[model samples]
Target: MRRRPSKEQFEQQIEQTAKALHDEMIAGKWAAGSFLPPEKSLEARFGLSNYSIRLGLEQLVQEGWIEKIAGVGNRVVATRPQVKLTIACENVTLRNLKTSGAGRTISAFYPWIQVEFLSMISPIPGTDLSERTLAGDLVLLDNVQFQQLSENRLTHLLEPLSEDDEWYPQFTKHFSVEGRRLLQPIVLSPLVLCYNKAHFRESGLAEPNGSWTWNDLIRHAELLYDGRGRYGFAFHIQSLYRWPLFLIQSRERFEESGEEFLRSRSSRLLDGLKLCKDILHNRKAVPLYLSENNDDINRMFMEGKLSMTLNTYMGLNSWNEAEIEYDISPVPYMDSPRTLLITLGAGINGSSEHKEEARLLVDFLGRCGRERESAYADRIRHYCKCCAQRLP
Candidate 1:
């Protein structure tokens, strides 16, 4: 008699089956919203038992590759697309905040406040959170202009802000002064640097060894670029924070001794800028600044045209969706390894009559993970619970 499949073997079989089904869905062999083949038939096709087939389909469903109806077979609800949750706040540690008794009681007692995904401005596609307020729901809110939280409010505010031109100034100004006391902020995940490991190996370049410095990265780019059609690197201008990180790593600060604007006398800062300019101009490492119309740096990287780029954890989903082989590593560092940290926080609206209740909900949403944290994290790489201590 044939021996039973080992647990590892069964897992491999399930993964292979899921990939085949996914490929079929992608090729239009199975139309979207159409029911997938029955478990028995798939079992026969893959030469597995019905139990194994169900296991594979369950895996697919969890990965958001398909959905199961109450009476209908599994249907291709949607293809998992890459989603990013950009959060902004003041505090920099990834730890949980302690709430007082008044805060907990307020949240537990509120009835009108509900937590739900707001579809109007949600960053992910097809994922809806339109409900007013629900526990463990991800909501996106910007800074309330000309508004202040009450001193006795005891509320948490979660703000996910991107480092955009318009928002960064407001965020810096808001958090530098007002946010320090009122809000607690933490980066949910480390900044992720992803590159095509296969491409690097094929081009006779070493796979980035987990950590690298600015000079090390430059050398690798120089060696990888050969005046050929292939380019050494490509990055979105929006991710220009990497430039400042280089300065920070070199023990240089952006602010002057007593001024708010960035300092100009730091020779190290000037050197880093000159290096970037050289890479852009002389080395021809990166393409000339393309107009917004044709500026899909992620797409270019996915097409296997570039060797490396600096991207956030959320960008990993995009690479996965594009089916390009890649690996994640910490962002390049300088003298001492460091990443420019960004975080989101929850706060109460001072004007709302439900201010007390809102504070409770904010604390629960920001700190509670029993229900919503995993689901959000699975959908978006950056939507992590503040207290999740696992290092990645």
Candidate 2:
């Protein structure tokens, strides 16, 4: 004596069957583009009515796992959609990073999800984000980009993650909004003066130190400059990381005066700009083409064609790998020793359909290898030492 199931019970059965199918698909039981079993077979296997089988396949269809052909059977679309993570990085490819510490963490924790990186990034203008412009499921944003995201109300894309003991307070604060974390800091790099030791020794000039001022730097650069192919010092004058020190010095000076803050900003910025312009135009200490890129500067430094350059921890991995003999000191400034703190963090896209999965990836990356004994910790330590940052 068999009893037919109620409509609600049938629907529940459909949901369960759909979930099972989804799990199997993720487990690679069915290859992508392969057709599912016939409707009659599905009905017989699940012991469900024809309607229930249709409903279950429809569920899979909605989840992007399968595509329904009008007259044909259901075909697999994708077992898992690869999450796209956008990075505004230079000189490195996504393939190179995917097998690193964070990449291994993601792979171990999320065996089913794949990650892809898109690096070309353009600034979002006027505090507005068009979905067309933001083309990734997750984005690695810098401080400036974070400010833009905050202004444009796009930070809602970031999932709020549970803070762990491994996170450094100073680094975490950089990505926090109104006490809420918008992203998790994965990298911390401070601006520093990376000078070629051999060049200073060859020029018979004192190497740069914390006490050195901008004037001192310029003077040493002039002394080191050879009238031939070699340059004394090099850096991008328009860089936010290097140029802001001048503004900070100006602000300190104006703090003791009666000038308004905005007025101070304009005047101080111009003063900073004038200083940089003079270094290029009048002093002729820097080459006109030094602004080409850090690649050119790094190449020249490695080749012993440049004396000093302003850089951050981001340059350490390459420099160390190249075995370039060099040392670092705090960047020279006018009023006090100042450097910009650069942070790299990861955030999820709010509109992503797979938000829960994205959150898992973000969370794992934030705490992957911060422990003392961990292999990831060893890697982090190596990178930190290269950058001369204090380990937490």
Instruction: Give one digit per residue, the lDDT tens place, for model 1 in 1-392.
Output: 98989999989998899878966764457766788988778888999988888888998889786888977789987444322221212111111122233234433443223332222332321122232221222222222211222222323443322232322232334333343433322223345566788778877778775457756776777666667656777565433334444554455445545553445555676665665666566355666656241127667777777777776542343344567788766666545456543334344433344333344455445444223334444533332112221211
- Residue pairs of candidate 2 with colliding backbone atoms: 157-350
What are the runs in model 1 whose C-alpha is more than 4 Å off? 1-180, 184-187, 226-228, 238-240, 256-266, 282-284, 291-295, 368-392
Q: Please give the range of 10 consecutive residues that has the lowest summed lDDT in model 1.
A: 86-95
Alpha carbon lDDT at 286, candidate 2:
76
Instruction: State which candidate has the highest TM-score.
Output: 2
lDDT of 2 by residue, 125-153 (tens): 12234444456666666565576667777
TM-score of 1: 0.48
